[model samples]
Target: MEVTPLINYINRIVTLTPEEEIILSEYVVYRQYLKDQYILQQGDVCKHANFIVKGCAKTFHADNNGQEHIIMFSVEDWWASDMGSFITQTPADYNVQCIENTELIQFNHETIEELYAKIPKLERCFRQITERALVSSLKRIVRNFSKTAKERYIIFKENYPEIEQRIPQYMLASYLGISKEFLSKIKSQLAKETKS
Candidate 1:
């Protein structure tokens, strides 16, 4: 029932009245998930939009060969959901799994609709959130095509310094679209360059 973090996150994008805050608290359901737990799985309809109050999660798609291609990572104060599925209420193409013990404030389709009806500002806040996510995804796609592996690795480290220490190296490598060995080499090369 802790909702301060959720309230604070929303306030950053749009100011909410005290009454609206209370309404939001009522609409959201707080949930905890253990590490490696799947909040969502491929082929299942995403029932809720989850806001991370704490911990980390990875959103990825499993290929036919069963290899997971990471789409993104979410940590404290971030949001995690299969947007396509959540909005459309269709089968999800990606899986959202917790990388650490996670606390989330979730809003289901009905509750969110009701909340939006009750507080019109919330709809605008969510729209902005979705737009930002879309922009970030587009940027990642551009980087993957235009940048070298080492360049992408450096950018990842720069953007997600907190995430680097939390997840395994292999997962990080997967996110960078490179092999673990290659990432190690890049790190070693960078280390040598820094030492010289």
Candidate 2:
């Protein structure tokens, strides 16, 4: 399979040599998951850094009441990992579950470190990615703290319209801090307003 987007995404920050690309391709494993399958689970150490090729996955926490609160959704070309756990080699407190049938490219930490040695530019690309992810995480926290459910839903729709279309309503509700019923009402309201 061609990995043009992965290459292009990396190339945006750093150009890799042919040999570096060869190393990357050799170490990277492609995987597919059906909806609701777990890519990672709480208490498991994240072994691979996953890059989405297509579809969506969410990282979430389950409470004692058996309710899941979604922290983030990773879509096509997005990178996903429990960053603290991945970097610290500690147990993860969240799960990464597929929202749709998905394809991903995963590389082990060690393999990635090897790539860093071979292609310093790759480190720069990954560093930038980490910075972006951090900013997104901070923004999510701010939204949770300051925005009402409807406002959060509106922002999510504006920012990730494609992801909104792909994921189920219940999951989106979980992510938006609203009950499914509330989200349905919001959806109906938005639809009615749009029709006018």
Candidate 3:
């Protein structure tokens, strides 16, 4: 499988020599999953850090009432894993499921550790990626508390216009922490305002 996308992504964060790139590629594994397949299921240890080559996935948690609350959505060029579980080798609280047929480049814990030892710069690259993900998560939390549902919807649309078309309305609503009906109302209101 081609790993150019993963290599390019890593290169953007940290320059890698050709030999280092070859080593990195050798350490990673490629896998594909069909739509609705689970990449990381709740209560299972997340064994690999997955980098999307193509496709969409959502990480979410199901509550006692059996409602799924989406934590995040990832697409091509994005990394999808339960970070805590992957790092700690513990059972995951969230499930990462494919929204569409997906292709991924994965690094198991041991392989990643060996890569870090062989190509020390990889540690820096992954650290930056982790920090960015953490910042994005924090920002989303702040937005959830501070922004109105309509405002959140507008932001979501602006940031992920492509994703909006791919996912179901109910799933989008779940991501925005609102009801499907409320999202429809918000859309209608926005449309009426746009026309006036």
Q: Candidate 2 has which clashing residue pairs, if any?
A: none
**Local accuracy of candidate 3 as per-residue lDDT tens digits, 1-196:** 6999999999899999999989988899999999999999999999999999999999999998999999889999999999999999999999999999999999998678888999999999999999999999999999999999999999999999998998999999999999999999999999999999
Relative to the true structure, how large is the alpha-carbon lDDT of every model?
Answer: 0.95, 0.86, 0.95
TM-score of each: 0.98, 0.92, 0.98
Error of 1 at 170 (Å): 0.4
Clashing pairs in 1: none
Q: Model 1 misses residue 58 by how many Å? A: 0.6
lDDT digits (tens) for residues 59-112 of candidate 2: 999988988999899998997678888888899988999888889988797677
Cα shift from native, residue 56, model 3 (Å) = 0.5
Q: What is the lDDT of residue 60 in candidate 1?
A: 97
Greater lDDT among 1 and 2 belongs to 1
State candidate 3's TM-score.
0.98
Cα RMSD for predicted model 3? 0.7
